[model samples]
Target chain A: MAGAPNQASLVERLVFRGTRIAALVILVVLVAPMIVIVPLSLTSGTLLIYPLPGLSGRWYEEFFTERLWVQATWNSVLIAVPTTVLATTLGTFAALGLNRLRSRLVPAVAVFLITPLIVPVIIYAVSAFYFYSRLGIVGTYPGLIFGHTALAIPFVVVTVNATLKNFDANLLRAALVLGATPRQAFARVTLPLILPGVLSGGLFAFITSFDELILTLFVASPEQRTLPRQLWSGVQETINPTIAAAAVVLMLVSVLVMLLAEWLRRQGRRIQGKQ
Target chain B: MERADRRRELVGWLLVAPSLLFMAFFFAVPIGAFLLRSVDNTDLVGAMPRTMAEIGGWNGQDLPDESLFMALGEDFTALPDITAAASLGRRLNHNLTGYRSLVMRTFTGLRRHEGPLGREALIAIDKRWSDPAHWRVIQQERSWLTPLYLLASLDLERGPEGIRTIPPERRLFVDLLVRTAWISIAVTLLCLVLGFPLAYVMASSGPRLSSWMLVLVLLPFWTSLLVRTTAWIVLLQRNGLVNQVLERLGLIDAPLTLIYNRLGVYIAMTHVLLPFLVLPLYSVMKGVGGDLTRAAAGLGAPPSTVFRRVYLPQVMPGIIAGCSLVFVLALGYYITPALVGGPRDQMIAHFIAYFTSTSVNWGMAASLAGILLLMVVVLYAALARLVGLDRLKAR
Candidate 1:
């Protein structure tokens, strides 16, 4: 570690070390449960109780083979994919529009766009359940997709808008000044520059839709059940090792997504640095 | 505005049109309609039109005349069957207790009747209806809207006389709201206590170590909520690792009941929300110059005094933002409490979920949700005022 030229007294050094140790401990507390889950999922016994009897892949196998688990994963994918596409496109456009407008309504419009992030999702679930039930779409994919899209849009808007903050409008002007039409300039110049943000925002939307459980509980029927809903019922209904396996898989997917997002973010930084 | 500026505004509006429409349809309209369910009284007025018309003119002192009784009998007999009677009875029972069974039994008696109905015969069929209180309740339900649900949420009930609080034994929603508030407050304080040192360390560290620490913090944020919750269940259950470690070390003779209780809720929620606190605080602390504290220290001030005078005020916005974020999130938390909490530990969100999903009571659900929404709005407003909502959006 590098130190400042100004020397610190014994007390300052002690306080620094103490705070560092405390921070490490807190970090462990935050990360320990996730680390423990992987090994626990490998326990050969049916029960999730700690102190493994032996190690086996039986639960993972069951997760892959069981009709309910398999179908729930498929349902989650089906919902999350459309949610990603829809939320990303709408959020990107809204960010673009906000970037262009310097009106007094900008703050108000931004707040409105982001209210889903602040509102208790239970309210949305109740409201969506009522509306979808009336429309006779309660137990269907489109219903869950629409509800999830509403929840996911704010995340996309926040991310894409953050990226737009650093965006150079003059690049588009340059493209337009060089005989490019507005649409062509946007497609060639703006989209490529902001694609990393757009993709990262889509990843966020995907995760939000994928992990959402409360809304799914309200709006989804048995056939429309997603993975989180399945996990909820599994915990409520039984204490089996299968849930540990599913949880491990869920964490794995989340980690992978995080890595992808981080890479995209670093790439965004690298692109910005190059420019 | 200039022509070019007007064109720009038009383009902006065109771009944002779809999202606005989407919010209006799926968000504003539906939520507005659902909140209206709390005051909706169309079910009763539509089902018992003649009874509503006749009962409107009657005073609360005594039972209505024979004509009103005939109308009541006509409405009850005209109801399709037990289901319709039970439905209307349930609506009326929101205002008056025991009307559900009263309506059901009267409907049964009316089903078997083969002769002309009158006030005397109706009273003979079910004597409870002879009381003016039940008649008053029916009359109160004649309106197209009522305060029954909003009042019920506060553990108050509407009567023929007016609104009054329910018995202490039945008082629940207020307690749930209070409990939810305290639990959220507790979790927010705990996260701040545990997170401040970590965030400080991260903010003060070199770039490489800070980025690595950032990854550690972001790991849980990116992980699935259910996954983290399930991990808590495994670690805190009766025969879980924590218990086994303590027992093996001779710390206790028996395992403590940690999971499925208030303690479990605090631990899990604090863990889940700690990152929220650290991230915002770290970002703010990073923006603050360290020289302020050093300057204070160099000016013959002690370290504690320097921190108290210089450091604390600068991070105040971060504190407010992080607390509001964690506190507001904790208020509506459902999954953690439902999975790990006991019956008494359930928050208002659990009840909202129960009424919305299990019991299918939109009125009760919307009322509870309305109260929860009010809390969120207040906290969000405070957050915006204290930390600036624009800063929150950047995060």
Candidate 2:
């Protein structure tokens, strides 16, 4: 490393500088559009034009007061909360089972479980529409919950599985040998360690259900329109600044979810590192 | 000891059963059923059960015997209602045009006839039925399954001679399939161009800087696709921020047509999918130390050569994984293209949705979806072979 600065050629320096600058410029382009929405959402004007007529919170107020927005928010929460609970419980157990699995079919099982995430959402959405119809749950809250839980389960499985990679099976054995039952062993020894994973999985499931559109489009009735579904139709209209406010609101939820997930990931890593 | 090991294994299987069963019931069976609709032809065969059974014995050129004509009359006359006949005709219409009207008209014609039902009488009812071409479609579709939808999805059809391409005017799905792949490849390349340098910088940076850059990438990465699409509209619409800035800079006298066009689709999709490529590439690059590049430089290899020869191969798996992820995701894109793309720019997924919701044609939708699934599975198998699919886990 000693001769690095001295030995570097002009082409080398120029290329590095160019890449760094290009990277920064692209990051701006990647991130600038979302930041642009905060102002547009705050615009008092009717259109999404620059040189705002003036700064105002009317859009936010409209977003809060409007029935469509309010109803969609409620629907999103109702679906996502149940989806989170169901997906997290089912997926954590699936991961725990997978972690202990010694069968040659483990790879196939994992692949099958993760298929919901890998396959196109449109495929799943269309099929779910048909499947739900067969069950007569096409437009119901329970249908969306079940539909969303399928999509969300894979994320939970992946997260918990990752956390479980660092988990030691002997801990369960030790707890059992100390006169604890299997339930006690799992509760005291394994649960606390995988809490971050479970929470992050739930968070992922929530956001996944919350942000989903295509599936909701197929399975949801007009009465069951969720936040993303509402934004979907609103964006198509392009006549309302209220959509911008809604977009910003959704973006905030996304950012908060991401931060929490990141923190949980780090926490999982920290706990694993200590072990 | 053996019993205990078996018990533990059983416990593992039991724990996995609930999720496995749920996905099977919800996800796998439904998609499998939907895709199978491309070949499903029970309704058509069931509607003309007598005709289907009798037609199997007839030669292609000649009119069927008295039993065949009698069975045909019975099948058409036995119709419980017009809707069943119409629905059967609709199914057959997919195989040969004009079958719907033929079946509906003939159903009424048979209903009115009181005397003997023969081949001549049936032909008198619907003159078009005398032609063997119509009979050929029924003959081919007598089976429980037919390739009508699958053939049509590729813009081909079974004709008098055999399978042949449809007329040029009607050939659409082949182009749409090509367009889907073309757009996906273009987006993947666009992502690679933009993501490479960013990942490079992120990997080479200090811990704090790297994490910050990672957040910069992940925030948009994790944002709802619709939100990102909405953001793009807010920024790229005419008189929007982009055009406003350009106008202020005197770059153009009028606002460019940005949103609702091809350029807009590229920009927004590239933005949405760029992180898929970057995250994996960045993680791969982070694992890839700079020692080799430095060693190459120490040996007098130029930066370009060092990069191409030394560094690129090290991150090849990442490039493959990331690019495939972007390409695969891009192929199934519906909302982005629907929201941003002009009518001329719509992809295969658009038609899949059109057939499902708008046209109410499950056969067409299933066939289109089948084509899409094939494309995805082929790419998936490739990626799974080249770089283990497990390595491309969602972050």
Candidate 3:
């Protein structure tokens, strides 16, 4: 019996070793493409045929010098910023309201909030084009902004709702009993508690609108084209190193935003752990 | 106090009112209109009133009347300039190809018409118009509510006589739908297979390992989709690092067909969508306790039996949530697949885009879109039934 038990332990240890190595290998495989692209973007060659010819920043220079690329970057920022603000505000408020609602309605409200996610984007995008064209707002900024907000709102609802799940209702009662006004209680207690979730939701909203492609293509005119739209047309009509430079910039921005979101989530976890 | 509660409820509704209105107008109404367009007969008769009237009393057995020819001549002569003709041509081209240039030429030739419209005048303008078949098409489409485009969208079309399925050789859209579903399902499965273990590890690991793993997983989320897809192209191309490594390692004799194919599509899409799966799965798994598996093991059960009977049941909800989330997302995927996947691998979204952009067939595009929406709803409903979403989220 001792020998048998010892043999089983040895087998378990070997399995654990194999699984860990496999996990590491999988991580390397997944991360390699992203790592490779960063270096290739710095290549001097016009065509992106691997084993990069030489090192240069000409593509990055071209990206800055080019009029359309600059305009598209500016356009993406314009759309992403306002979209983030709008989606985050609406989504946070909705999440708070839903959290306060009788628990029975939570599932129903959740289903409603998730429609934009469930429906295929192509359908929504095409319909939006027709809908906007009929209203005569197809090529306008507000039109694209609202369109992006609709897409981003779902992310806000999901993220904020997740954060609110852990919230204690008694905290609100405690604050009220302490003679704090309703508004004051929420500002001092509720806001501080859910602030990380709100910020994470906001970051997701910004990245969503920033990275959005399909709907932007439908609604954005040449003058209002977003970064993804410009990159799309660039790929279709012509391939240039400038696109690689733009890709590099987009990669950096996305990574930075996600990193910030991860940091906030960690802080929230730590706070919860301490409690 | 009741009044105050009511007021607060009203404010809550007011806050969400704008978004709801936006979705109703831009999302719901347009889908309704798109479906309506499939059955819309206004344009067929609206464009050619005289021919419509001339063909009203005609039967399907015989050729159309001379009056119909005269109406065609009149309609062609009064047709708008090349731009309008091109737009009309684009609409008709959705039903049948080669009609765009024909319509444009006919419109251009009509600018030089000399006499009152007749058969001779029609023949003089375009010899192709003399065919009875061409006359029959004009007569058939004279109805205000012809179902040509809708039928063609479903691989069926109405001839002068009645509706017929498009020839097998000409069929593409149905195949496109199947391909879309296949790719979406494959991507969903791939995400689950790749993400399940990682999410499990994240849930089960120590803080240091989990945080490091989280950063690695989230790194791709920081980049734009177009950039990530382009990166895959660079890495998977024939002479790219992947192939080069394979070649040097004696894994193959020749550069393998990697990028610009279904394999590339799978690799790139799986990479992009893995995060969606992991985030949801990890969050759900974080709530599941590990003691159950150990408890089962200590009860005189084998490890495999313990995992099957105790562990898998608990993780089912996470798996379902992750699968549905990834599957629905994969269905709408456009940029990644379009850039990496070859022509045959194009999904339904690609055709929706093609019809919207290149073909300009709003009706057909909407019908295809309607089908996609219906598929998602059905799948979602089925998923909800299989594993209740609340149960999934709770786990």
Candidate 4:
């Protein structure tokens, strides 16, 4: 302590404190807008704003009981569940293959696969509108599901590949040396070890499909309207308490999915740390 | 041994085949088909085959001969009444405006006539037929393929002589493109100004504090985009919370017009894209610690000088990566601007969506998308040149 004198002068200290305060304010700016809606949704007033007029359950009742909102929620769930399963399965297999490929072109292939994330959503929407209409699948559930699965597959690949990168090949070799067949080794040893990554990837896929708007806007029909689609129309027509209500519900699902993903990530780290 | 090695390679390929095939069919094919549409013009030739064949032989300077008009009349009478006429008119309107209704009216008059259809008869049906400019449009679109949409997307068009910029009053797309670039640059700069200090603090703080701040950032990342955008509307609209707070504090007599404008767009977009900048910059800053700055201070350099010379240069890669990411995303933004921006404040993407969904102008839509995709690819190539492409993978 004596050897290392106060290197930061008073002016520097003041600037440092100012930056910390500003950073905290920025953090608040980031989180408060999303969290503030929870209280705003509960307001009895018809308008979407702060300062509660009163407390009521009317908006929540509308979100639950209204035919359009309920149908959209159901459609989103229907599409998202299949999207999660399909994208997770395909993306995990692709990641598994990529991990063992030993090719210099792996990065290029990965970039090609993730173009959905890099390219604008409007482009995808336009493409889907054109192709699906030709196939007569426009406004159909399968068409919407296919579009979402393509978009979500990239996220699944990215996360699962990250987890697979640090994985030890020796474990599977050991399982094979123990007289287990290759399939048995994969099922009994590899699958269990990477199950957290797979699950987290699936959760990410689900959230992406659930919150997706543009693809749904292009491919979905009235019967196939998802929650975000409803919210979009809701926003365009009127900014009311009902939208805040829907937003609060959507936020709850997102937070739960996020927490699950965080838990899975930590669990994967712990398992790797143990080895 | 060679057979076994080949078998293993086959197995590896098999595992990856399904996703690749899916992307090729669903992702690659559709975009390929779209890009092709920008230059593919078969609508007029398919609709008015005889007319196209007749016009192909006619000279450009004069009105078509009686033979070409006779062929056009036969082509018109050979088609269904309302749909084909309207469709041809719409297709030709891309080359020459108002040809749609002209073709429609001509079709209706031809349907009611009982005389020989020739050049004079066509001229009597509509005075527009006598104008050589309309014939030029027809001749221009006579081919099965044309670069009209592609040229028009850049606010340029090919006339009798050569390619030239469109009239100043009609020049729109170039302005939209420039505006999109300007807004994206502005947002990127704003994010840097707001995010750099935060990333620095996150990187320099203790592990526990840094992780907490990381969660603060990730919470927004995990939140739904629509949820965040809607929250902005609530906070920024005229009757919204922001104005309410300002008025409650007696800051002004009236609420500011915050939403539905460029200012609103910047506020919302910056909030949405800030985490993108912060996360990458944080990783870079965390890698290069304060040791260098401290060492520079010990060497008698001032704090500002230490930061400028020692710290900032080291983080150039991160800054480039983050800005390029933010800028590219900002250029293609659809939902945020569409929801918050006024008519004059709309970006290129909004117009792209408009042409696709409302106008059903597939050629124009593809052309606009092609221009956008070209811009992004060039930027990425520049990024790859500056920073190795693999570095983007880490981000």
- Which is the leading candidate under lDDT? 2
Candidate 2, residues B1-395, lDDT tens digits: the string is 99888888899999999999999998899899888888988877888888898888878787667887789889999989998888878877777778889999989999999899988889999988778878877888889988889999999998778899999998898888888888889999999999999999999999999989988999998899999998888788887888989988999999999978888889889999999999999999999888998899788786778889999988988898999999999999999999988997898888988888887778899998988888899989988876754455432
Find the candidate with the highest TM-score and give its number.
4
Measured over all alpha carbons after superposition, the RMSD of each candidate to the real structure, in angstroms, is 3.2, 2.9, 3.9, 2.5
Q: Compose the digit string of candidate 3's lDDT tens values, residues A81-196.
A: 99999999988888877766544556776677768877877777877887888888899998899888888888998898888888777888899999999999999988988889
Better of 2 and 4 by DockQ: 2
Candidate 2 overall Cα lDDT vs. reference? 0.89
Scoring only the A-chain of each prediction against the true A-chain gives TM-scores of: 0.94, 0.94, 0.90, 0.95
Give lDDT tens digits, candidate 2, residues A1-275.
66755566655778889999999999999999899888888888888877789999999999999999999999999999999999999999999899877899999999999998778999888888877898999999999999999999999999999888888777878899999998898899899889999999999999999999999999999989999999999988755789989999999999999989988988988876776
- Per-prediction DockQ, in order? 0.70, 0.78, 0.49, 0.73
In model 2, the Cα lDDT at residue B302 comes to: 69
Clashing residue pairs for model 2: none
In candidate 1, position A104 carries an lDDT of 95
Evaluation by TM-score, superior candidate among 2 and 3: 2
Write down the TM-score of every candidate.
0.96, 0.96, 0.86, 0.96
The superposed Cα distance between candidate 2 and the true structure at residue B253, in angstroms, equals: 1.8
- What digit string (tens of lDDT, one per residue) describes model 4 on residues B1-395? 97877776677678788888887778889888988889888877888888888788888887788898899889999987688788888988988788888998899989888889988888888999999898888888887888999999889999778999999999999999999999999999999999998998999899999999998999888888888899999889888878988899999799999989999999999999999999999999999967888899989787778888998988878898898989999988999998888898888889888998899898999999999888888898898778865466557
- Please give the distance, in angstroms, between residue A107's alpha carbon in candidate 4 and its true position after superposition: 3.2
Query: Candidate 4: where is the Cα deviation over 4 Å?
Result: A1-8, B389-395
Residue B239 CA error for candidate 4 (Å)?
2.2
